[model samples]
Target: MIHDTNDAIPHQLIHDALERVISSREIVNSDRKKRFLQFIVKETLAGNADRIKAYTIAIDVFNRDSSFDPISDPVVRIEAGRLRRCLEHYYLAEGAADRLQIIIPKGSYVPQFVMREVAAPTLLRALDDDKQSTSERLPEIVPAEAEFSQAPVAATSSYQPPGTAPSRVPLLKRPRLLAGLCSLLAILTIALAGTTLFQRYQVSVSSRAVPSQVPTLMVLPFENDSSDPAQNMFAKGVTEEVIGALILFKNILVLGADTSFQFRTETALRDAVPNVPIDYVLKGSIDRTEGQIQVNAALLRAADHQYLWSGSFRKDFTSKSMLDLRRDIATQVALILVQPHGVIDKAELQNTVGRPSESLTSYECVLRTREYWRQPNAEMHKQVRTCLERAVRIDPDYADAWAALAFIYTDEARIDFNPSAERPDPTLTALEIARRAVALAPDSPLPLQALGIAHWLRREPALSIAAYEQARVLNPHDSDILADLGRAYSLTGDWEKGIPLIREAFDRNPAQPTWYRLFIALYHYVNGQYAEALAQAQKIGTPNLVYTHVVLAMIYGQTGDRDNADYEVDEILRLYPNFGDKAVFEFERRNIDPAIISRMLDGLRKAGLDMDPDREVANEKD
Candidate 1:
């Protein structure tokens, strides 16, 4: 029988037994029975077999039930005590001579099963010794058979004997012990299953190890201390500058300003650090009163919540330039945060001459441009271009301002926003401005990243990769630089190298705009991996989900789903009426695969979209 334990049992039988136990009136009240049943099911499924200790099992069960109210009712501890008695009776009677024996020993949550082992002489010897000892302990005057026959018959019945208490007899008896063992094992099985099901309901739960060699830090938003509400932007600008400075280190993981700013409303530091496992946190506050500006900052250990270093600085706000003061604070903060790790030496942090200026006006313009860029519409594009132009005009030498201008122009050319205006000659303008930026600050990664983008737009994949590689060396923590490099590698048909880099960027910044997801999908689609491409496209949660639908249409067409593909094409045209041959041609010219183009065109044509003769000729030539 033990050798046949691998045989399958009917699931219906187990379910029926569980239902009967839960509904039985002889045990306890309805509510108590229900709770007990639920706990037993959860335990049997989730409790680790290797760690059978009672306390461990209690903690596991209590943690799962949010309403258990550990302070008020000790449900886990009380249930364990009752379960032990129920199990003892089941094993003694029906299971006494069975090949398989289930036992839930006292002071242990994990159940143990015993089976016949023909080869283990030591085990057999131990069992024989125990039997002899039990026989000797019994009184010699009373015969064993007579004592067995004289045992009360009430033990096997549901009703108790008159004038005798139900709890008087020991639970571990001949016929009743089998029932007790089954009860305990069944309850534990249910408990284990319930716990596993509950854990699966949580969101964003991940178990990833952080590399020991990489340094990680979180920068909190700066506090606003000025009486005038208008001065809030200045403090915000200072916070962003520190983030930008630390991002220049390749061996660091600096949380971006967009994610870090959300922590401002959190009352405690622990509340801000979610799944982002980091080594340190940097916090600061700014005060502006009576024409004076004061900034206070501190570096804290994330594990112990202790302030490792702190400092305060004061300057006359009316006389001293705000940009200069911000630059001083950014440099000081970087030095203090990285000095202990010995990653950024004192000399390197002190040499901040050629770095981008922390001008308040330029900072405001960049912030506004970022907002407009997120809209992804023609009007928003125009607004962002204007803002970026003003940022460059305000601070002509600012490297970040020049980079932003170059990025916007290249994007406009790629998207064909102004096909009638001589294409704006963006390549020439981007190349020249990017070169000037590199000349001003040769070591800074910002200029290098800009140069890489310019080369990428010019179709110089090798040069673009080299520039991005240099940028990565200067600032490994900059997700933007890594993402751009990944894109360049994909465009050059190096999908293997591109996928890992893009995935790392996604892990670091999960809430970025849809542009990253779109690129990742393109990489998969172009490689003929339709399923992977569709999966990634579905992850994108932006208003421009239309792009995902367009990709899906192409995928469906390739896979021979003509009806679904046609429906997708119709929806795209309905949403954007002007979407026509020109729109398709513009997308195709950007090195998008001709196979994808043919599929999309076939779906659109089936949906009543008129094809332009000239555009078809150009596509054929390509």
Candidate 2:
């Protein structure tokens, strides 16, 4: 709904340009410059565009007090000059291909936007294709005058020679026959041309190559322009971060890993993406030379293969700079997609990403873990766990690492991955670790999220809901957190509040994950929509589905689909053969509600599932 201000760059395009500038390696590598860019743009967007001058910038962005003088101290002027040259360099360099141009004119803080022009070659090609199609369809529909023209006849003149005698002569006589014939031809020609043109328009519209829907983005793995191959991580990391950030925009559909997995090189993308209908393709590279680093990136419209925007940023290298670079790119990308209103709250970012990492290993490990966590494969989960463990060991104060570890442990119990008979109790350890994470980073939502999950596993729904609510406050836009909080609300018997939250999650993420599907299915099952719940459960196509199968089994059993229910029960038994045994029952008693336990057992009984070989089901209550 946010529109362009005045005749300036359209609101959406302006956001895309801002994203380009902020993510430019130059901005990401320099924190001060990035902050300056963000504040000035924000101010401009807020309509104080012209009013923002040296004095205000100094006082607001530079933190100069009232005692600061514009004339006496040239901090604002100097910084402004630096900012100007930086922008100029950015556009001429990294931002060269950007469709929108944002300029802070000389001697003014107000920003003006200019949209870039696409290349003529691409335009000409599109036009040629259209003409070819039209020509093919209308080859025989030539104008009637061209097809049947009357030969011109000289006007018959009755006159006498000047020297001889005068004779009756008509100086101007209308050629009635010729005029009438020409008029009739003109009318027919007009009608035929109009019909042909309309048909061309209809054909063009009907044959349009791409689908009309929400715009989609596919971010490719960035190339390493750096001399050292090890530095490729910076580019790859930035690419991953951009994907993460852009996914938050509810309006944009980001193609997840599978569809984008092969897009590693320019050649690969150019060759592969033509077959796929994508709105835009983002490609970038990281270059490091001596102490300075430069990142160059561009967005291309997939339909025409035209570059929409391109930019390069340069900055001096520092460990801290490297650490901040990836996230800054992501934040910038998101802002570009949604614009002024979509600027990620700095406080939330701080809470989620944490302050600069003291240890690179911990940071890198956590990044790798997050990558693996998205995969629905056992190998990926194993890698996720290993990475988290290594990260926490490297930096004991790494709250994100501890939070992830605890979540994984709690998840093992939920999925029966490490059932009671096969493995030692992990719920207590997971709960303790979650507590440690919350104590260490009270401001972070991730740790709070983990704390909530741990409490839920321990059957303390009140504590779980409280933790989830707080987490929601810390990160209001996060879909996963919303869904989790809603699940907690529903589990505590607040279906009215919970259902809306789940619906919001679906709205936010057009391509909801398998986990999301399971959560929604569970909510439906609890609400007694057995058929809907079964349908939702069937949509979970994750390679490592666990608890989803149980939900499916229960839904089927409740709906009297005994064969399917028994099939699911057999799968569960194979996973946890001693599910109803004494050890498992004791563990369940400590962490599960009686009502939930009874419901699960009832469904399984209906599905013809058997008690553990060594124990009677009635003894479990004791």
Candidate 3:
């Protein structure tokens, strides 16, 4: 007997069943299906059920490489489904008489064995003795070939107990009748098979035909867990506030309040919208105690009920106004769950692995853009550029794709990300793309952000600030926009307003990128707070950007750390060999306030970077 605590089925029995099914004519024809079944069953038998995951199956059974990502490539999932149907057909036909049956349950790879009931031959033999009289008492007999012709055996194929055998009238003795029955069964079998094939074809087309779309989320109504009727109203208010805040994000699609409110529980939501493939659900409860509002919220992956993120927020309403408290909680929660590099973006990145650019949907292109931003580099930026270009070609109406592509164009022009590539004019190209994005999505914050960046690149600081401010108004929870607007303000020497805005953006987004700290560090350095500025600059790690090194060199130089300061200058020169000439040129062309530029240059000069135009020309001559 197998030593599995859950099942005591004999090991030999399972092995016999596996051999019978795999060697059967139904499974023997297809190598892929046969191997799929054999691999999972053997692994299960060997007590290696844990190794039967989709990733392992793709590698071991399908010859996929080590970089196989199950989410983007559905080969294993598709094969597992086909194998399951194949097993059903096998058991209903040739393996029906076997005492043990091997079955692979849905949504899992582990194989199981169940006992097949044996028929009592003696009961049929007794009825056959009195044929003439038994004919009247017996139910009409259906031929096994006719009965098992269908792929899925009908429920009417129920087991017959030993003593309750139906009387048998042999149709085989009437050769004409048997032949006609066989012909009819053959026609039915052909029609059923054709229908099944057609259905499978349709499923195959539907699975791959649809373009990848933005992940959708459904926010269930928050349950009121307090006795006060006012708390019930507050709960509903919070739910609506969250829904409103979530909808402001351009990437994710939040279900309408009407649709979301109809189902409060996850089970109820699934039962109601069986066909709606919601990717995530926001659910929680609200209660009030001692004049304080306590809200517990969790973000769940709708497919598996896995909690992707959860939070418990407590606010003292006695110290703050009720409306302010509600808005504050909703905005904070929304920012954490949907902002760039937040919970949803991180989860979506995992699903987008190994997907080729040409096959990406518009939404997937946008997701890929975020991946590039997470670790902004030249190689990944080119990949993202290709993806967005394809996305816009395939889905020209996707505003988010256009906006992301606009950023790529800006990067190419402003930073010379692809310095090898020559173009007539990328700055105007970026402006045109940004305008197109805004034309497509006038109300979306992402489009406005792209427009703002384009304007900034064009040296139109006022226009850039206007666009950033409008975008912030559109999506107040977007930390990137706030940060952009803050940087714009600071560049124009409105440090009073800019510093506070940047600080607020930082507080709102816990996952704000390392560069957001750059502005804060500069802010400290500008205020002559060397210790605080150095601490902040060190926290930024070694980012691959010339500005990061410049700021660090500035801070180190001010603190009289000559060694580290020289190292920072060397790193900057490594990135930009002719820093002396480039710095003077960039300072002349950039839209930054002249005073701020001069101050930053002063600090860089102190860090051992000879920022003299005269000496740079002399060195070239030498």
Candidate 4:
């Protein structure tokens, strides 16, 4: 009914495309994203595209109050970006061969339904038919022109200019023109053929190179071995809860319950489904002893039925509700399996052992960056940076790769990492790269984490904290984000709130870097516990940072150990020769508490560090 062009897309075709996208459990998993897409598509179909503004979406679809301001909140814009990405991924995968495309162009929310371009084989066949018809008509055109030339012109009867061989131009023009056109067509055909071959060769080379990919998982039907028949329902509920929790992790894909429950066991799955695409399968059993229920979970590699990890968790159902018990156990299992440095992450990293850097995919680059964080240094940072740079170049749409690369830039800008290596405007570059990651994956917490670091490097702690809080809301179990938020809060003089966050992070993932230990030491030092602070400081390993030595010197000085304090002060000066001169400036730049900075400088002076600029400058020279 809204047709204004010859090739208007059929309403049924548009609706079919929408169905294909929204029905894809893997692609558009978020109910919010699905709703966003459906609302815009229905609006466009109803000839109300103009009315589909951010305010309208917030009010109608998102259920926001009328007081919502787009500029301030930007929730609509953010979710719109996410929805657009989901649609793009859907088209690239399952909808690749569809006859129509539903695209939401940037800068607007209106959905455009357009007919897909002609298939390559069909287009080539059409071109061949056109060429054949042109060749067949060439003869008739030539004869018609010859007859016209032979008929002669009546107005030229009196022209008697002798010579010129009776004007041979008309006789030779057609053949020469035809020959030139044929030669041009032949050259084009050869060039196109060469280009096609080159492209195919590139594809072949890419295919031969093995790149790491995102791991997929399936939660199989759980077996109930308990006496109570109602425990069967409990086991099913746990499986469903686990599937729900695992789907939140962006790095791993979780197959839906409908698909995963078809087979009872791994062997049945393998025998029934050919070449199962899942990498890991989680299956568990439920058993009740007395008032307590026990859940034993096992993770198995789908390819060979090899068990990767197994754990037993028990909960007292009498003390807690059944729903809460299932959720708690599911969360524990999810955290153990999917968190950073967890089983799947370690397995994936191990799987990248023999792969060359050039063949490393975006996800592999991200995983490698995680390795660098655990053992941060100049050499490893450089290697990680190069890997991530190549990853973004290879796959521009990989948001995690972009985010990881931005983190490197942020470190370089803030810490002056490898100062001898000349670089330009790293701060702005870091922020821009982080923003690019956010734009690429608006709903992902990884990009938001990178954005928070970039903001912190730019000396915007408030904005940094805001980004981190949003990231925590998206994925509360990410320990790295929690530690980062704690660092932010502590640096801004909120130790009461910050220390617990840091402790929680450490409890969640104890295998973190030594820099985290420094925070705990500082927390003790602030509370006037010198022995505790000193003990915590000793656990920090080398290549130790300046802040680590500074804290050590302060704790030793406060505890009346002049020799150890002086040794720490000497280490600091040896590492940073003019630290005394820039110590205050550095502390302020890092957003430390004023009182803490004063106390630190006083302790340093007590430990024989001269705060005088002239003396520090002379020391640097000597």
CA lDDT of every candidate: 0.53, 0.57, 0.69, 0.69
Write the residue-wise lDDT of candidate 2 on 78-105 in tens digits.
4565567668756653454566777777
RMSD of 4: 20.8
The order by descending TM-score is: 4, 3, 2, 1
Tens digits of per-residue lDDT for model 1 on 313-358? 8887852366567766776566445522232322222333234333
TM-score of each: 0.41, 0.42, 0.63, 0.65
Q: Whose lDDT is higher: candidate 1's or candidate 3's?
A: 3
For candidate 3, the clash count comes to 0
Residue 453, candidate 4: alpha-carbon lDDT: 85
Positional deviation of 543 in candidate 1, in angstroms?
Answer: 4.1
Identify the runs in model 3 with alpha carbons over 4 angstroms from their true place.
Answer: 1-212, 266-273, 317-320, 420-422, 614-622
Model 1, runs deviating above 4 Å: 1-360, 370-375, 417-423, 526-529, 542-549, 559-564, 571-580, 583-588, 592-622
Go through the candidates in order and give the C-alpha RMSD of each one to the true structure. 30.3, 31.1, 30.4, 20.8
What tens digits encode model 3's per-residue C-alpha lDDT throughout 277-357? Answer: 678999988888998889999999988989999998998864325556666788778888998878999898878788777
Better of 1 and 3 by TM-score: 3
